[model samples]
Target: MEERKQLKKTLKPHWVWAIAFGSAVGWGAFVLPGDWMAAAGPLGVILGFSIGALLMIVIAVSYGQLIQKLPVSGGEFAYAYFGFGRYHASFCGWFLTLGYMCIVALNASALALLIKFVLPGVAMQGLMYNIAGWDVYGGEVLVACIALITFAYLNIRGTSISGFMQFIFCLTLIAGLSLLVIAMILHPSSSFSNVQPLFNPEIGAVSAVIAIIAISPWAYVGFDNIPQAAEEFNFSPKKAFKLIVIALLCAAATYSLTIIATAVAMPWQSLIAQETVWGTGLVVENAYGTIGVILLSISLAMGIFTGLNGFYVATSRLLFAMGRAEILPRVFAKLHPKYETPFVGIIFTCLITLSAPFFGRQALLWVVDMSAIGVTIAYFYCCAVAYRLFSWTSTADTDVIVSPAKKAMTLLGLISSTGFFLLLVVPGSPGFLGTPSWIALFIWIAIGFVFFMMKRKDFARIPKEKLDYNIFGKTLESESISSNTTKKEA
Candidate 1:
């Protein structure tokens, strides 16, 4: 008897891993913590980083478990459909798509800032002067727009090209981090005293922790992005799980080292007070003079571009999945025959991302705050679903086996996500506004819900079997078929 091999359609494992790492190392490393530090100081940095990392681990583990079960392309949307229902799924999809788009824009803007720092005279005066007829912020916006367009074109070409670009950028980013770390180590005055707290304010500890949690969530936001690459893993789920854990460990180490280096090299107060939030260049310049600034600037530019590339890829996929499921217009689902990529989605995302420059600091802060709330909401849903899945599965099922250790991790994740969610909703806190971001989120969610209801009939037309398999699992196939048949008759 001749046996046939099941042909697998998937992305290379290395690319999947690279995307996960690249996604996490975005503007969050430089900018996210700075915002937190501004509110909390050096101690705040340590507190924020530790708490954020812990919460992220929980989110990541829950996501990892969910991916093993579903392994779909839509990330949270897919998870929500299975765990909750159509309404929640659509809400998550729309919210996550918006967040990713905003992140792309944010990274692009940061890249422009980096360019201005590197070549102050040429990049600033020549570029900004010619484009907007103003010497405003060195024309980084114009440069960012150009870079966004170029990257969008490249991404529209294929995932392989985008992955390659991320690898290069990741390397450049490492080099930049290395330069800063070395400088801090070599400098005599660099010490831990700057970050060491003499006395913890008795009254403010709880509030400070809450504030830190709200802003720090940004640093660990992208760890959940790994599950989105489930369709790309070449190995078994077990191996993929191990890989993610290892990668997270590495990321933690990298972040911890970078923070230590930054703290040691610069006065905590000075670093916090600096108007320009991208402190890597300043750290470098402080250590190695002019040459350090040039190197750091180049590295920062590459890192921003790489992060933007990741955002583009992730959001495009989310849009593509929404289109495929008919939650979005079918036009967004169109893939370029030659490129085998979602061309329309990419173009749309890029165009929307260009709005970053017009958004001043206040608007930018609002966008970030709103996006963070949305992401935290999604994380909460994911954790809740994980808890349910763990509880509902049969004890004897190999696939559903829940170790004490696994359960503990999942529990911790759920707690952290829930706590953070509550923190975000509380008003008058440092680094967060309760009602504004929540109101923004509600408006977005309402829009999605309205669209879902309008298309409810079309969604109904989809075979219940498909919906069930898509949302729940193959294990629920029989139930799905029965339910759909009954609905049809009704």
Candidate 2:
């Protein structure tokens, strides 16, 4: 008989922290602040993000508890299975995969966008066809593909290399951005007078903060990535919550600080009016010329790299977990003999992202917009699962009863997650998805249902016991719960 394969527990707390923090603050920090500033002025943007980050902390509490309880690779997939059944697990896995894969692709294209900002017209060479009004170019495609390949290879090599790289990149990103922000603050031209309006006139103070809050799902996505890598953590699961909370605080500060840095540098109103390709870069350039651009470029590159690397780890691990549970093809679960990495899933993510550059950034944005819905759904699942699993107990033993406070918090997370989902899908809402994104979303849901039908019998016959073993490494049990519910509760 062959030995059952397992993922190595090589992830230290720092690497895990890197995966959480580095993933949450991606290329959006450097590139999108100007758009955010335009919609909401510096104070509005900062306050909105600060509020959003706090809400995310509430949602993350459920996730932290689950990581402590489950400690599995599939994240919400495993949680959904334990709480509901295989059907919900399949649903959770399908949508979460969309969110992760789209971000992986989105990050690659962000790299191309970064390059174009650094060297104007360089990515415009060898004009390819245009999609959704954004032209594709051979130069941009080559750059994105090269990045996809390099990161895929690194992931296939092993988590240690990728995790270490992410840690180093995150540190360098912090250092570079710190220097750039400090330079912007100290430059002779910078002035408090430049920030004339603390809030945008068009969006209104209240409305502007609301707008920033609506996009919170996208801005803080990389942190939930912790649950996906929980199976690899070398430390006690007890420590996962601490790392997640710390990472969340860091990410919140980074998003808020980046905007402040840009707003303080120059007159953001004029920068937005000019509509430069990259307003943040332009701000730094106006402050210190070539030297400022170089500093910003290095920072932006590191930000992009961490996003790319972090999502690659996330997407691959989710796919690997699903495959091991027979939710995907068995091949996706297979590991590289030498490196013991999920090479198949890693390669699959790379191949999927490689095709994204061809569609142009405009087209890709539609998918990303749709994907926020997918991630919100996953958040809902995690909180719901946590609530059901921890709220009530089956045993008569007083010690086994979960605290009322913890139970209430999970319910709050569930409700907030549901709100996040509604903000995206509810028509007439400020954060509602466009027609294209809605169409893509329905099509994706339809496909998930169809795939479920094809595997319906297999899912039924496999037995939940076997699934627990396959996905969780053993049949998980808690002394307080017998069948996730007690006769008294039922």
Candidate 3:
């Protein structure tokens, strides 16, 4: 019992907001708006994000119910543990880990990409080896290395410090976004005539929405970070559930407004035609000139850092939970006694993230796309867990049953996740990952399969002790409250 209290429960409500909302806002917020404009015109992008937000609401509701029932550190992994036994839970955890790790890598690569765009020649000047047709520069790799190490260290220190950093950055990001939107509206340089052909004729509205849905996981990745740190929250389960919903709405606002701001900053035609891929910065510069671009760059850096920090926290917690459960290695569960942070897991994740920048941004994006598929699989499993628990009398020593309202939301979440997976993988589908991404996905899955098979013996004979952490024992408390309320009414 004393050792169980080792992890500090110090995260406040705002910290929860910072981690979840910050993680959800990522490099996609800065870079993907142009792609959104291209795939779906201004009208199409708006509709795409709107539908995407609805889908996220369903998933968030499902997650909220699950987290209230069992507020633990593993997030999706914990949901799977309660639904299916260790074997399947291990698979789910590993799959989700791949997704989080990819996001970490994606942020690292994005840092380099952002720097290169902001300060030209600084990133590309120091030429290094090339891989897969992308040039790997020493300057770029150096920036990524610094980011990876810095965030890992921050997380290693503790969630409180990391959350503090996240809060500052998130505050700055929101402020900057508001200012950008206002600037775009005031600046007459941007012509409303630029937003012609509301819906993209090439893809049509249906496919455009599907593309947005396909990339939805990356766009809104941070909301689940709240649940990933469920054990660290110094709040009630009900409050945690409510906060998760808030995080999702905040993320939706950030992405939607970002898209609108991009369109309003510059004509879509001129924005897309620039030789450089960074349409966001160019649009901002065009709106308010060089000073505006610099501010936008600063805001972008903070946004990227927030994402990097949030994912670092998430990946570490996930690996720590998996390690404690003996899914990967027990070493990953090791926490610094002084800091109570999962140092080993943090280091391991940092090392893995450092490798991605060498492949450059495009390759890193391939990882992000593949991660979307992985995360979607985990989402499906989580919804399945909700369904199983909703109909069952008991699970993982808990007597909680999902209410009908929550059950309906779970069903919707399941359906939405399934649709997303199909869109992502189906041939001739608008949202299909390209050949390179597919190859990467296959390799990652094969590795995970090999690990699972190797651990089958350990998984089969999993000791009773490890199972204890998986059962959160919240059902009894819930039952007590319900009984008290009933008695008072009588």
Backbone Cα, N, C clashes tallied per candidate? 2, 2, 1
| Candidate number of the best TM-score | 2
- Candidate 2, 287-355: lDDT as tens digits: 788888888888888888988999999999999999999889889889999999999999999988889
Q: How many backbone clashes does candidate 3 have?
A: 1
lDDT (C-alpha) at residue 287 in model 1: 77
C-alpha local distance difference test of each model: 0.66, 0.85, 0.78
Q: Give the TM-score of candidate 1.
A: 0.85
lDDT of 3 by residue, 96-204 (tens): 8999999888888888888888775888878887777788898888998999999898889888899899999989988988888778777877656667767777878
lDDT against true structure, model 3: 0.78
lDDT of 1 by residue, 357-468 (tens): 6553345556767887777778877876776556433475443455666777778878887777666665555545556566767877787778778987887687645555
Which should have the higher TM-score, number 2 or number 3? 2
- As for candidate 1, its clashing pairs are 82-471, 124-138
RMSD of each: 4.9, 2.5, 5.4
Q: Pairs clashing in candidate 2?
A: 23-222, 24-222
